[model samples]
Target chain A: MGTRKIVIEPVTRVEGHGKVTILLDEAGQVSQARLHIVEFRGFERFIQGRPYWEIPVLVQRLCGICPVSHHLAAAKAMDGIVGVDRLTPTAEKMRRLMHYGQMFQSHALHFFHLVSPDLLFGFDADPLERNVIGVARKYPELAVQGVMMRKYGQEIIKATAGKKIHGTGAIPGGINKNLSIAERDGFLKEIDQMLAWCRTSLTIARDYTLEHLDELADFGSFDSNHVSLVRADGAMDLYHGNLRAIDKDGNRIFDQVDYQGYFKYIAEEVKPWSYMKFPFISSLGPETGWYRVGPLARINACDFIDTPEAEVARKDFLSVTDGQPNNITMAYHWARMVELLHAGEKIRELLHDPDLQGGDLVLKGERRGESVGLIEAPRGTLFHHYKVDENDQVTMANLIVSTTNNNTPMNRAVEGVARKYLSGAEITEGLLNRVEVAIRAYDPCLSCATHAMGRMPLVVELHDAAGRTLDRRVRD
Target chain B: MSDSVTITIDGRNIEARPGQTILEAADAAGIYIPRLCSHPDLKPIGSCRVCTVVVDGRPQAACVKPVMDGMVVQNSTPELLQHRRNIVDMMFVEGNHFCMFCEKSGNCELQAMAYRFGITAPQYPFQFPEKEVDASHPDILLDHNRCIMCARCVRASQELDGKNVFQSIGRGFARKIGVNGERALGDTDMAATDKAADICPVGCIVRKRVGFEKPIGQRLYDTRPIGSDIEEVRA
Candidate 1:
């Protein structure tokens, strides 16, 4: 056979619009593979000239799955506009509580709704029976628990922020509302169930990983720097903390640094094929600087998790490795579940804090011209930087979302899967699914990836050397 | 003048008081007529025409049209709804209503109306009119791009705040809500606490000191589509 091509036009089971293309040489050998993000919404450009204060709410439209991250991140950036370096304890606690809610809900959504079907039913299971509803059909109890688990997290967000999707709770210096005793008690009553389900889900996720250890251990595996935010004591911190990056050799590339200095370490690369920009560490250069983010990267970069239950799970997740940064791509699902457990534990801990119900929500401050905000979104590290005029109107804005940070890695994983499983034989639907499974491991929010919009349909296409259509597959 | 009158709207008989507009009667009867520039607290202006309904086989602005005894009105008919959706689509195209990048988005009445009408995209061509933003005021911002010429602010300032600080400038496509005769908001006596500042049906006028104080998916419209409350009230 002459050189051929295979294209997965809309990678299924991911958050938004994306595709993977594999090119073969004259010998029918893998020559190049790339994952292209086909969607674009020019949020950064359009947000210019908008009032700086409106950013937190305006940017949430970027992605429905992880709007809280954008909300919190944008608010933090505006904190500099108000000239407040740190928020009051009460304000900080409320924001942290909201952040934990976001983390739990997003992770629950990914693990239960997005990835569980693939793991539980096997990657090559009947496509129609390989969805959240399918998982519900096979394991109705787990399905119900999953829905409730996500709902529990959403309810916490609604109670704190005012509503679940795009509540205007977090302001520049602080928040608009504090947790009421009644509201706190409402969540407190459900904390036990939340924790129990989280633990159960974590166990299932671990077993799933072990059952598929051989394939997962080597599937889409590659060495790269891992990045995330860590608390002062080196524990995993999702809401607020310093940026940390660990190299493939398991050495700290950067540790506990203010996110304001991110420009010094990170730079973005743009390509013609995709509107999504490729971000990399400045020191390592483009190819080497492409580090991974999100759950897997977060777990690898942190020394230990703060929550006791999650710390045990974290140890088990890291056991398969020889003390090096875990490079196995499929382990992201496991790391995500561990974080979900930690989120539930953290929510329980914060609810008991007296400061959560305190009256001091906003702190007055002067205005500054520019600022940067950074947070570990459920997907990974998210950055929002803005420059305002003296009138506090945003003159310039830039955002580096979590999915963009992992863009290079996602492409690399696609390349690896294609080269391994697709080089020589007739491409089967099952083989194409393996490639998509690798991409799903990242749980990328492509909507947020481009600061965009989309029940996106997934399609795969095959072509001959002459670009003649060979085969195509689509999933509505 | 009779105290009460009966009218049939959407095939349902409802009571209406004399001097009440069709919209007012609809509100009392638990029927929601989609509208802009119309607020219970403000006098009905009938500028947006979103609530246009067929009364006795004639199109009328429900907010201004008086309820009548034995009147046959069409509120939920396919023709009326399609016309309403077109009016909304025109508003979207005429102004730069960038809901994806707007602050008042989820809570915005215009956006909620669009969602309620299932307006995925406006059928009209986007003008992409270049609009200006007035950020001179420390506590408020007036973005001309998102304005729909609703005149809610004009009535709000003149009638409610008694400030009379806002007025409509020009006519036709060039018309816009001006702050104190085209002066900046800070140059006028309009305070952030003024009713005019809060009465904007679109994202045009917004308080500057706070943003995203609420989380996403939990805003007023996020919880339920606009006009849902009226339906609930009817129930």
Candidate 2:
């Protein structure tokens, strides 16, 4: 009685290509499972020798889904290169608007287009019916809201960044453009409607999580460290802040450390099996240091939400776990909605501010040779570091994307789900779906994480103890 | 006015100076013959045949072809438009032009010309040739990846700056703009204010620490076509 292997390649409903392998022992009990990010794109190498100013626009090629995150993060790093510690008010506000717009749209997209099908219809539902189109056919109103909400956020980005594709909004030291009065007015007209829709989506997620708390509590859930950016006073700050990492009980492992010195506190570990790298706290090393990021992690690590509406929502979310970190993987959806509401509130506040229309757009100071930029992207914290030559050519680049940060946690979630759901030698559709549900909770962008390319179809393969294929199932 | 010569361009009668080339005559008459190498202050070099025009029955480089009295020239015909577009397309593929991230993006004449010609993407396959970036100069950078070998900088260095700092070296595929000094641009007498440093039509030669100074919509040729200034004269 040797072990058998079950493989799910190109996990569906996620941003990029990933594979899940569940190993079963002689008793048909799950022994191990891993989420393998298979694609390898040498983006960091491609960025070498490029002019420092081009990085903000160049790094956007990493992921189309979260180009804004890369754009802003690279811009922040380049700002340090240009020797500017702080941007002008107008520039800061404009970039914040652009970032919140990105957060709003990205979170909305993950919830509606990617995760809603699974939530609306149980995870065991037919594969064909578990998609956005299926949602449109059965839940037309929700589908319409998702599309409109995503579009609204995109429109804000276009107005701020100057276009939907390859936006050049953020630049070194500051943003390239200011929010015009007309642009502000345009968003103002739709703010109320967007806010209403945000509430509705939050209600759906909150209700769903609360209704199935007991079931989801044990479903792919685990206790782990959480990392995110927090304002100096410990409020959740997506755009800019110092680093904060907390353990599962919400105790601060590290607090208020400048991200510029992140390499001192955080380190990345590499394994032969996957293209993605596992990130963990340097002090705790590889095993206990690994942490979660994105919505669930941010929700747990922050002392409070800065916005009014989102503050209330955060309290309710915290009450569910008795003011402790909620480690339930499925709670990611609810956490995401709370963030969505915060982004909306922040957007409305920024739009009404006079600073957005200010004239000064950039500030310059003494330049530096090396710098790091960090931002809490929709999925998680994104890091961009670079070393520039005196001639302004980029000599080195290192990126730790959000998905890559969650590498270990995703594998752990896969293993947890596989152990609980997998049974017998024959592969079942229900088991395959559960594994995906766990991975999708993280909203991992395999493409961005691995810098991969090409088509990704969910493929599940069953192999006997001898490593020979017994049965295979594919969903494209 | 007395030395002006009359020419028929695109079926329209236009007056030109006796020594002016077709491109010069077209410029004086508010008609635009698109060009890359030809500049107002530099001597015309008849390279980068983007300004090719049919003089009478044969095609000629508008930048070098003198305007003869009663000369007939075809400028913006359908065939000529496609020919110019093809030339621009070749320039796009010949170099690794990452227009999206290039500092000279909206302000680059080569990029503006492509926009004017309605080119969403280059028709030819991208060469993606290995290129060198020379950033030895303190205030300027020379990225060979964006060079189209139009000789604007070469002519400007020789005729305008009077420094002879830049010269074309090698031939055909191996051709590149070589600095006067043996090593790098830092050793050369080239200054940031040199006419050659500001004459490149692409991102080949750009000032350091000043990229993306102007926002997108406010950049040159953002709201209008490349030759809108000359075309606006007609209106």
Candidates in order: C-alpha RMSD to true structure: 5.1, 1.9
lDDT of 2 by residue, B1-235 (tens): 4688899999999988888889888887889889888888888888999999999999999999998998999998999999999999999999999887888888999999998899999889998888899989999899999999988888898888888888899999889989888798888999988988888989999898778777778889789889879877766
**Model 1 TM-score relative to the real fold:** 0.83
TM-score on B-chain, cand. 1: 0.97
**Candidate 2 accuracy as lDDT:** 0.90
For candidate 2, the clash count comes to 0
Candidate 2: stretches off by over 4 Å = A1-3, A451-457
Which segments of model 1 are wrong by more than 4 Å? A451-458, B1-130, B146-166, B179-203, B211-235
Tell me which residue pairs clash in candidate 2: none
TM-score of each: 0.83, 0.97
Residue B30, candidate 2: Cα error in Å is 3.2
lDDT of 1: 0.86
